[model samples]
Target: MTTTVRIATPDEVPILNAIRTSVRENHMTLEQMADYGITPEVIANLLRTTGRAFIANVDGVDAGISIADSAEGNIFAMFVLPDYEGLGLGRLLLAHAEAFLHATGVASAWLEAGAGPGIRAHGFYAHLGWQSDGLMPDGQLRFVKSRAALTQIVAGG
Candidate 1:
């Protein structure tokens, strides 16, 4: 199967949200996700504004998504369909988001990982060399990565 990652358009917000909702490990139901501000309208606005969203398609099917808020030096979101996991799509999307943030002159990027059985992101971020920076105001664990460190990691030393 072939995979392609590309900038996501505003029109793809629904697909992005769908992928996010399908992740049982997120520990959030559709209603809860909306309460947490994961609505399509919010995502669409992000796509239209300072955020950069990328979609990963496998065999021409929407499979994953990654989003970054360059202005805030934060990874706003990243999700892959359960069926598409273990295919390196998440890593690819993350790399693209980090590159985009670095290109925007961001020195560091951060993201909040929820605490629960449904939250499987901490290990993934940790595997990519991100460090935990304590809890965010919202109580989620904050993960951070620096551009310089990422550069060194990519350079293999």
Candidate 2:
């Protein structure tokens, strides 16, 4: 499935919001998302400010999305549609985000994932060699990865 990852424009905020809202696992309702500051307006502002939002298209369809905060070295968000899961789109999006961070002179990156039921991101991050740094104040699991390590992994060490 020819997957392409590209930086997103402000106009694609709605599409990015749709991909984020469509997550079946670690699901968050619109109200819950708003509580966590995940509204479309917030996302649009993020895209405008950082220009780090990326969309992954599979066979000409939006399959996943990722957003990185280069200044903070944070993988702020990443989500893949349920139907697109297990096809490696999520990993692809993550790599794209990490690469962006690296290019921006970030040596390390971190992200928070849900710790509640139906959350499977811990395993995914671990499998990708991210180090666990325990839970955040918000009760989300924190994972960190170094750009040098990722480069080694990608180059087959």
- Lowest lDDT block of 10, candidate 2: 148-157
The per-prediction tally of clashing pairs is 1, 0
Report how far off residue 19 is in candidate 1 (Å). Answer: 0.4
Q: How far is candidate 2 from the true structure (C-alpha RMSD, Å)?
A: 3.5
Q: List, residue by residue over 2-93, the lDDT tens digit for candidate 1.
A: 98888888998877777877885665666887897778788788778878888899998999988989788998888888889999998988
Total clashing pairs in model 1: 1
Regions more than 4 Å wrong, model 2: 151-157
lDDT of 2 by residue, 1-157 (tens): 6877777888898888788888977777778889977787877787777648879898999989888887788999899999989999888888878777777777788999987755789899899889999889988999998878553213111
Global lDDT of each model? Answer: 0.81, 0.81
Per-candidate TM equals 0.87, 0.88
Clashes of 2: 0
